[model samples]
Target: MAYLRLFDWYQTNKRDLPFRKTDNPYHIWVSEIMLQQTQVDTMLPFYDRFLTIYPTIQDLARADIDEILKVVQGIGYYRRFRMLHKGAQYVIDHHDGKLPEDYFKILKIPGIGAYTAGAIMSIAFHKPYPATDGNVIRVLSRVKMLEDDFRLDKNKKKLNEMNKELIENSNNPYLYTQSMMELGATVCKVSNPLCDTCPLQEVCLANINNVQQNYPKMSPLKTKKEIQYFTFILEYKEGFLMRKRTEDLLHGFYEFVQIESDSLNGALTQAQDLGLEIQILDELQPIKHVFTHMIWQINLYRGTISNITSPYEIVHDFSQVPIATVVKKQIKQI
Candidate 1:
């Protein structure tokens, strides 16, 4: 009865997001993959552009990886896009471009995890599988007054069981899934939740006990390790020198020559070792870029040189280089 009430309330009061309008497995899978670590507002334009370019699984499967990367530029996590490309190809080759309706079969895709599989099952196939993302976890913890750490595997198992039960009893599984996410996003927010307007306020455990902030206990975050980097803008009469990053961190992206050192002098020596006659042009401002687990303190050094030769490609325009967001910003500022 309580679950039905929540579902009923959700039917009338859900946000109209683009992904919620259709049950197309392709659309749902794309949106779910894009929204992994990205916020809704940031993803809106990108999602529209992506769908416009490659509207079907076949289109994406046939497209080149470089072309796809160009479209998804400015969105972080390049590896996710690569995996998505692989997944699309798999769908096209194995499933004839039709996404599988079975939950377990869909989960077999490279990037599709439990949350994504659940979302596709409920929204696309109308199956009773719950998508337990961060928002849902927060809402469930607060509503149930769970004291255990939400990040633990034991708690995750319990939460998944609770979610499965909720879905099984839900009158409309699609609406129920979206409603839970909507409530967490709008009413039962992380901080300063609108408890007065919340539909579940009457029975919400967090609100009744006045411990909303304490119910969803989060694990302590690890400190970001900082590293100093010196990036050189090596310009000659013809073009600038840039190299492609071929490793896991930022593979397939282009950036200016970077040297890891504690001091600027050490970076200069390293540059000279690369067989380039270095002439210091101007010292631009230092830039700080933070990744998920790493912090980079980058110092920008510009110089004009002649007779520079290396494996790097020389491009006349800096913007044409496929640099990462952090390196792109640093180049723009210089």
Candidate 2:
């Protein structure tokens, strides 16, 4: 409802994205999966590369897991790719190679959540549905001047319902979804919103009340757990030693042998107890990598190993392996 200005502005100002040019549900679904927890600019190349390789739901379903991971290695958050791969396969196996048009049916796919399902239905299927992402929440919360903490489930549901009504009234679901996304991303930005130029400035209560920054009230975030690890890259005659991580955070990826110790001496004692003797050649520069809830303060040190007993493999080349970005950073040091 009353989205003409927003739609007109989007037509003139929206960035030319590959996904925007197509109404194909498969393509849009791929884009939605990639865009989760990733910026458009960053996900663009990987999107292109992934499409070049997979090209269709069938291709994506049949492709090997390692190949899938290799294509999207540097994108961080490895689990997104894993789930996307499974979702595509689910489409092939269950939906007969077509992305479902029905909202509830599409959610059966492995990684398609409420927001993704809504996006697909509205944008690709041209059905009136609300895609209530963070941007939309911010925009709507500011417009209605709701001070309820959106972090809470009840407040979020309220915003989602409001957006649902707005989209239903628009009658042009595609433009309603895309235009809202564009407005939130480009104009009603988190900081320094361009209120004077915004199409919805008249409707935005926060802008009218001169409280643009305060409307979408949120609870404080949990503190990130910081951990110090003495990272090791011990080289034998074979190559560098790398451990296959089975931990949930970075599972099915390669990482250097790392021990949770603040000091090298402590790590060395631990290493000795494992029946491995490392001749420390030099201490390379340290690196820090931050995940969603945890931060790894990696103290990197590269050296040659004299004796070994713990199970690990020597990697001559790591190009094929699904190496995490943090491990890749340490790789750059050596």
Judging by lDDT against the true structure, name the best candidate: 2
Which candidate's TM-score is highest?
A: 2
**Candidate 1 lDDT by residue in tens digits, 134-208:** 888888898888888987888987898888888888867787788888888888889998888887888888899
Alpha-carbon local distance difference test for all models: 0.84, 0.87
lDDT of 2: 0.87
For candidate 2, which ten residues in a row score worst on lDDT? 306-315
Candidates in order, TM-scores: namely: 0.95, 0.96
Per-residue alpha-carbon lDDT of model 2 for 154-249, expressed as tens digits?
Answer: 988888898999999997999999988888888889899999988888888898999999968999999999999998899977788877888887
Going through the candidates in the order shown, the clash numbers are 0, 0
Give residue 114's lDDT in candidate 1 (0 to 100): 89
